[model samples]
Target: MGAEAILEKIRKNAEEEAAALAKQGEEKAEAAAGKIRADAEAEAAAILGNARQRAEELEKRERLMAGLQIRKNTLAARRAVMDEAFSLAGEQLADLPKERWEALITRLLLEAAETGAEIMEVPAADREKYEWTPEGNLPIIGEKSFFKRLNAALKESGREGKLTLADAPANVTGGFRLMGPVYDVDASFDALLSQAREDWEQEIYRILYPKDE
Candidate 1:
């Protein structure tokens, strides 16, 4: 329910507890002898004071809890928005047009290439999409072929066009990974987005929540 409703419920409960304490004090004061009644009256006053203090504490505690709940909810909502922002970015990457997608992937592949002879491992679906023929062989020399573009990029980058495709597909999408002799460079969409998230999270948050609200 709403915070107001919760607060109102807590208010009623505290008031009821205070009323019960006041009634008990009244009963003790009424059943005492004259002198004893004076002592009982004083004790009753102390009891009422305690009840007021306890009620105030209960209100404070409830308010604190309500405040915490609100903060938790706000943070959860903000996180949801942040997650959606990243998800949309990934979706945009996935939905890139063929030529555009190839160009983007080619750029990443070129940048990630160290020796230019690394095995390019892409997902099986990507292999079919790029028409990667038997054992890393390019189907034909054409601008449409992604493999030929890789060789062109490698040559342009002052490296041998010895880059070959892995026989087995990589568990990746939107990009490929370079398996070098000593290391590997992941250029998959997941990896790219993950890194981008880490690097640009604060910047994106600033744009999303201008006041940091």
Candidate 2:
């Protein structure tokens, strides 16, 4: 072959090699750019996830604090109500008259007779009103005026023979207790007041926190 023809062939081979190298460089650059973009996207996703978690935690903490505050207010209000009720009851009991006491005892005795009670006990403060005897069939103790009144009332209702009066502890207020052969009834002021509190608990809460609705 001629030297010019050989030189031309060598130049053509070099050109082809240069073209292949250029193509390889372009592919490498594109791969590197794609990897950088993927890494950036992954970092952005992590940041977004962390932000969402922090927001949720803050909301939960706020809700917990709010609940604790509400509970504290409710307890304080309930305590105030109990105090007021006890004070009012004390005032009423302190002002009770002897005639009122006797009437209350009579009513309690009639109720006990209706319930088939055989024996009754009452507060020690009301023993004097029970001196009048009924048919004298039932033994009556006048040591507790409340019990005596109960026995007298029972006797007046033809149940005197069925009921006996006993003196209870002096710690009790104006109310009386009825004890049958089988069961006993606690009709004391404390018991009645306790029932009243139970019955009015919901109403009290409503009055205290009407805005909660």
Candidate 3:
């Protein structure tokens, strides 16, 4: 072959080899870039999904806390109202009329004195109003009295009854305490009201805190 022809053929072979290498490199780079982009898009979608789930969870937790706070506040308010009502009722009961007070005491005494053998203990504040005689009879005004009422109640229950007032006054608010040989019965207004409140707490709560419309 001639020298110029050999040199031209060598140049043409070199150029073709270089072009083929460049095309292969470009194809590899494009494939790598496409894979990288796809991975990045998938990561972004996962991150967005996680963020949404966390946001929903946080919202639900906040709602639950808010509901609990509301319920706590409502219960506190209801308790306050019931306490105030009971305090007001106590004041009214303490300030009851003399006639009503006497009637209540009489009824309590009648209920308490079952056998009439028990001693009826009265408060110092009530010593002047209700006086007991030595014969175990208490005079109301002149003839009609608590002894007759107690006797009538006991006889109706088919039991002989006898009641005498205690010389020592009780420390109580309005009601009396009946002392038998074995056990003593507390019929005081404070004690009675406390028991009543315990028994009727649910009913009282319902009345105080009705469901909202």
Candidate 4:
């Protein structure tokens, strides 16, 4: 009712309104800060999870590559061993004794004689190394005499036995060749060993790398 009292009442009401506004502003600020903090925490967790997943994938890929490299190296080493084994076989066959060499050739000719009329060609090395006859025995053409003997052997095996000799030396290391009209039989030691290597690879592998038994 008094002017002073009315002014004081208005002042108190204004003070209360200002305090309420201040409290509301502080609460809103706190809520916004809490939301920002939660968002930041979630983003950090997501980044950490993604990093861990990428690391695991990279580690798995490295392990697979490492295994593949080891297998590749192992295969290369095994191939080297097989190659050496065949090389040694060729050497041994080439170094057979004279009697054994002749016997082997005779056997090969007998086995390979489809029609024994195929032209027989000797390797340059064989022509040089073969002991065709007894030293100083009788036949002046010792090579010819040896060929006649081969013909006899062929005839005994129920073949044509008329294989003519070739003028040029055969393209071979050891053993002999029989050239027919259609195809030729390569009885060269190198050729025989090459074929044998293919046929015996599995057997050789079994010997080289045995199972648990």
Candidate 5:
């Protein structure tokens, strides 16, 4: 009811109000801090996930590039092999002679008879040497002289009855083709030399490029 008592009441009410405002400010600050921390964590996780995805994509691209490079190298190697094989065959054929060719054909026929070959086919160029008949029991090639020589050689080797020349001309050069019931023998210079070169190609490459080893 007096002035001092009213002043004390006013001071007490002001103190209580100040305490309540302070508590409210602290609560708001804590809530804001929590929100900031959560936002920071989410941002960090997003950045890490993006970096991981980018790294995986880079690795996949590198692997694909490596596979492509390997396939290209393999194709190049096969092409080199084919080129060398044909080149060597051409070089060998350039210097071969008729006598050598005839002798080789004779030998192939004899060997074929021994191996149970019933029919022997030779190139048209060497047909005359074997004395082949046009329509006899033993077949003859188109060239008469090559057939004569072939027949003579077969008779000399005691394989005339078993050695029958084929009427069809061969597809190859400087070699005879022998056909049996179950197997075929190609004794042509091209085929023989090709096989020899194929067997030696790896060794030759190693010798030529020793650093590759």
Candidate 6:
């Protein structure tokens, strides 16, 4: 073949090879771009899912916190009401008539009396208020008051005991302390009511909070 023709054929073959390589390179680049796009979409979907899950968790936590606060408030309100009820009870007892109080004192003394000798400790206020009488119907000591009658009542109630008023007063509100050589009895209103407060709490709650019913 002629040199010119041979050179032209060589140039055409070189051009075709270059074109094929260019097309292959373009196809590889496009495939790489498509893979990158798919990866980015997957990453975005994962991020979105995590954000949604976090939001749901936060909402659930907030709801739980709100519920706990509500319960705490309800308990506080209930406690306040119970405290007021107890305050009213104290007031009512303090407001009792003198006659009723004497009768109550007599009953308490009678209940506390036992065979043999016993001593009664009353509040300082009661000491100034009531008088004491020795054995048998006598003139009396201190003032004309409940303690005088108390001894007679104890004897009549079949308690074979000498009830003597203590020199020192008791630290009590409404009831007295009965002391014997064997054992002592505390009939203070604070003590007796405190012991039964737990047993009575539920009943008091039911009476005050009947909204559930």
Comparing 2 and 5 by lDDT, which wins? 5
Q: What's the lDDT of the predicted structure labeled candidate 6?
A: 0.78
When sorted by lDDT, best at the front, the candidate numbers are 1, 4, 6, 3, 5, 2
For model 5, give the 10-residue run with minimal summed lDDT. Answer: 134-143
Candidate 2: tens digits of C-alpha lDDT, residues 1-213? 999999999999999999999999899989999999999999999999999999999999999989989989978877898779666986686467767756765675576565444656556654444543444343454334445555556667776445655645435675767667667778777777787788987787778768876
- Report the error of model 6 at residue 94, Å: 1.5
Clash count of each predicted structure:
0, 4, 3, 0, 21, 0
C-alpha TM-scores of all predictions: 0.70, 0.68, 0.67, 0.77, 0.57, 0.72
* Model 5 C-alpha lDDT per residue in residues 70-185, reported as the tens digit of each score: 97997688669767866776666645676775666666677766534267777787565455454443543544556555556666776544556788988876677888777778
Best by lDDT: 1
Residue 163, model 3: lDDT of: 66
Q: Which ten residues in a row have the lowest lDDT in candidate 6?
A: 134-143
| Residue 199 lDDT, candidate 6, scale 0-100 | 81
The better-scoring model by lDDT among 4 and 6 is 4
Question: What is residue 14's positional error in candidate 4, in angstroms?
Answer: 7.3
What lDDT score is found at residue 136 in candidate 6?
A: 26
User: Candidate 4: TM-score?
Assistant: 0.77
Using TM-score as the measure, the top candidate is 4
Which regions in candidate 5 have their CA more than 4 angstroms from the true location?
A: 1-42, 45-49, 52-60, 63-67, 70-78, 103-111, 115-117, 128-161, 188-201
Worst 10-residue lDDT window for candidate 4 reads 127-136
